[model samples]
Target: MNQTIQRRLYKLYSSSSRSSFGLRNRISSLGWIVVCGLPLCAFMASMYPRDTFFQLLGVVSAVCIAAFVSVLLRKAQLKVRRLLPRHASVGRPLEYTVEYTNLAKRGLNNFYMLDLAPDPTPSMDVFLHATEPGEEKRNAFDRFFLAYRWNWLKSRFLLMKSKLFLANSVGGEKCGKVRVELLPLRRGVIHLQNMRVVLPDALGLFQRVKRVDQEEDILIVLPKRYRMDSFDFAGQARSQVGGDSSTSTQGQSGEFVSLREYRPGDPPKHIHWPSWGRTGKPILKEYEEMFFPRYGLVLDTAVRAEQEEVFEELVSVAATLTSEMDTDQSLIDVMFIQQGAKVQTVGKNVERVEAMLELLASVEIDPVADWAALKNAVLKHADDLTTCFLVFGDWDDERENFLQSLSSFGISLVVLVVQDEENPVKLNSDYTEITLLNVGEIEQGLASIHL
Candidate 1:
């Protein structure tokens, strides 16, 4: 397709999608009556058997035309406020309440409210470049024109289900509450900005839609998580500096050894009030060296386009470990590479595990694996790590080299390779620490691990 023509077609396709959704949602039961009568009206009018047939068609057409005009005659103003939850997970129903206040003098009646999320429209460049999986298998016309590409992008956004809630009435200068439930199709932030309120006329043929500008708020949708049992990993805990105190932001802390005069830079928490009161001077508590174990959770972001599902399964696998692990015993570092290697820690005194879940929720696949950078990121903290759990979409040379590199530092390694049934992974016979998990068989594969 020509670039200029595709750009024009993109605009047409986008407008058509929005118009289709609007027309379908704004029509009432009586509206369908007019639609069903159209064919009959055409057939009867064409028969020419009698003048009465033409007269009947004219009468029906006038009524439908009058209803359309009547539906457009009404006016309304409303203030909408939507209450959203702090977080929602994919495949879960996010139920919230919407409060509508009548801002106009007249009472609002026989209306419904339709909650909306931002449309996930694909850019022209993406539409042109990205192909739906198996797109080449389609017919020549479809493959040439990219017909399914439009449907794929539309379907991706439309996967979220939000229903219209009916309301009998809301009196003038009054508020009404309607519960709205939305099933999120994907994980990430759901931005709520505008809502649609439909007011149907007495005939119920059509409705007047009023757009309400809502105060934009976001709801974080966490990635799907699987139920996991306690499991042991080949990774071991390494002795950490300041022991458990390493988990806290304070410089260094351990068991009480003695009391010392307060230094200018001593943390507030380390101040000994009793000793200070006894000596009539500021004093600080000193402690001995400590030992705390930490673990590393490495996720391979190097994914090919065909292995998108494998990547999702890998994330769920990582999420399962992140949420199910006993963080109290140690700190966990979730590491992945996007443009560069990044690591975030979760455990006692650090960010909660939910924080890591949020990261996984938004993590995208790196275009290419900078294995050197990722290894360096892990190696920087290798001394504090007891063991490392690695998740990969493929067991290739890059991954095998990565494993060997980390193992060289004496870090116990457990590698999980998500397999695609169409292209089964070849297990390296020498590596016994590898776990093979099929794409759709994740639950059963992980079921074998228990403490």
Candidate 2:
């Protein structure tokens, strides 16, 4: 009962805040009409008391009323369609075109259109609660006056009130296009709700809004990627048939398999001299494929409620490594526990990078995911992986034991532990691949990895 009441209270507050913002904007738009029109009409009537001026005032008032009524009655028969990309990167500006077609017989004049965008960033209330008590207390007043609460409220209202006027006239039975640019401040899914058209009176004193619902376009904003030149892991390459021979080829550089007719781009070194001399034709030597490095990226999704920010940093690190690694030359396997333990494999030839990023964009902390299940998932792929990159939020004993167990499998392991400034770096003498990185200085820590 208490939870229900609290929820109701929150909903009420949110609705009231949004309504207040809309009211403020509406007043600002028509404030001059009320402030000047009423007094001028009264003053004119008082001074002229009879014919000319009073009659002129009545005529002006009637015209204003007729214009307001016409605007209110005007029906905009518009078809709105949006063209947007499938994905966006964080901190990058994305531009999409919105096409509006006037299907009515009469043309639309002096009208504005706006695309409704939903905010995906965390709310101010969540941010305040995430901060320490001292910090929260220090900024309590600012939070009340200068926080995103009002901004979100205003934005929510403007989605219904504000719009972009068509610079050029949209004739009847014609189509017009407008481009909208949005800069995503964070990583998440942004839902494009609808397009709103506002038709205002001749004097621009009153606006009539029409909302045209479109198929919701969901844009996944990927996490920011960092530059990583290379990642080196300590392990012996496994030999496999039909595998890349760049890293694990044994004997005289490569094992020659067969000779084939030389192609235009065939290197001179690969040309079989004996075959060319015997057959009197250009021949190229084919070698057995070498082993390609396969790396496992284990993301620790088990985070405490308060340590959500740490998980975000861990995700960014994972995304950066995933982007920088040569998927074409090597295979990357991403392992994380969502509902259950799951693994996604990506390679140079595959177009799964966007899928992987989409998964990462919506990943949330799941405390219920057992550590044993996560361990088993990684172990299942141990034989195929040449090296494994483990991104963890905390370096607890359980996690250390998990890494130790992975190291026992002889697969090279690189562990990146995200910690706060207060937590001193803990050196692990048992493993050579462990690197401690403060959440504030991830780039420096990643750059310091020598092996």
Candidate 3:
């Protein structure tokens, strides 16, 4: 019975306003009404006759009822379509157009529209961090007092504050457009659900809303990218033994090959003017394999329960490097383990920067075996790579040994270990390639690195 009541309350809160003000706003408005109305009623009772005071109260109640009825009787037929981008980025504002067509005979006025965006999934870290004995006991004690449920309710209300809302007025049988702006707080798939339209009474005391069901559209928000212009990886491109030129970027010295479609980062001088004249399309001349610098991006996916934030910082670092590094000059192979060992190449005409960030946004922490699998996957390309960037969640003997192994294989290594405050930044003076970055201070760390 308590659960049922909570559910009903939640529904009422969600439906109260298109702005998503929820129950808190409703209660505040009621309090203000009583605070002001009671004083007026008391003054009238003292100064005016009893009959007059009662008549004034009755007139006010009738007016409120009439206003509510006016809104309740209103009917509108609306057709809505969302024009959104293919993807959005975290902490960036995403603007999309919502086109609405009013099919009702009468116009709509003082109505607000809200796009129903799904909530983000809770991270496993939240549950795992609370698994300690003391924490668990505290949680059990809180549950006994129903504090857990209250906390959940508070979280739900806070989540509603992030929803997007727009207000507009449209004439009968006319088309209107509303630009909606949303700032995503995290990286994930943002699913757009139904749209709610709230029509308030003329007095603005009550609102009646209608929900227009929409075909869900999913938008993936990529992880945040930072500036890493000062960072550099030293390497040399290996010669291709056989097959076609596998280099994604243009070679500094190579024989001219056949002409192909032009890529975004391709140098303008490489454009084949003759081919463009003949084919009436932009084309670029390919080149033989030359000194193509190939770098391996080794991402550590094995994160402990409490290291989720560090893992997220690792991902953002990868994304930043992927964006800042000129793929037109070198090839970067991003290697990580999801369900299994997977490698994604970004350089030349292989893949775009957006594709790489999308992959990073969805990567989750895996088991230790998965990390081992990633090592094996990188070894397969060992011969081709001249340098490797190792991004680790923590630095232990196992990780140190792995870096040493890579160094022994003639592969120059640049290591970045993400650490928390409790874990002080410690560097082995012997390994010049290693750098320690505290979580949330990545920009400062990168700027401090001279090479």
TM-score of each: 0.85, 0.70, 0.73
Residue by residue across 128-189, what tens digits does model 3's lDDT show? 22333223456545533433543343443232223436557899999888887777766767
What's the distance in Å from true for residue 405, model 2? 1.3
Q: Write the per-residue lDDT of candidate 2 for residues 1-451, one digit (tens) a residue.
A: 2445434544666677668645543332564565457568768889779777687678767766776676677678788887988888876777778888888888887777766556323354543334332334545565444344444433332311223545346889898887766776567777777577777676666667777646777878898766566554433243444444444222223468998999998678889898899999999998865555677899998777557568888888889878866665567789987778888888655556777888788788887757788889889878777778999887667777888888888877778888877655465557765777788788778888765
**After superposing candidate 1, which stretches have Cα over 4 Å from the reference?**
48-63, 157-159, 230-272, 275-292
The TM-score that candidate 1 achieves is 0.85
Residue 319 lDDT, candidate 2, scale 0-100: 90
Instruction: Tell me the lDDT of candidate 1.
Output: 0.79
Best by TM-score: 1
Which should have the higher TM-score, number 2 or number 3? Answer: 3
lDDT of 1 by residue, 73-105 (tens): 877788888887788888889889888888988
Clashes by residue pair, model 2: 244-290, 244-291, 245-290, 327-348
**Candidate 2's error at 40, in angstroms?**
15
Local error of candidate 3 at residue 160 (angstroms): 9.0
Q: State how far residue 178 of model 2 sits from its true place (Å).
A: 1.0
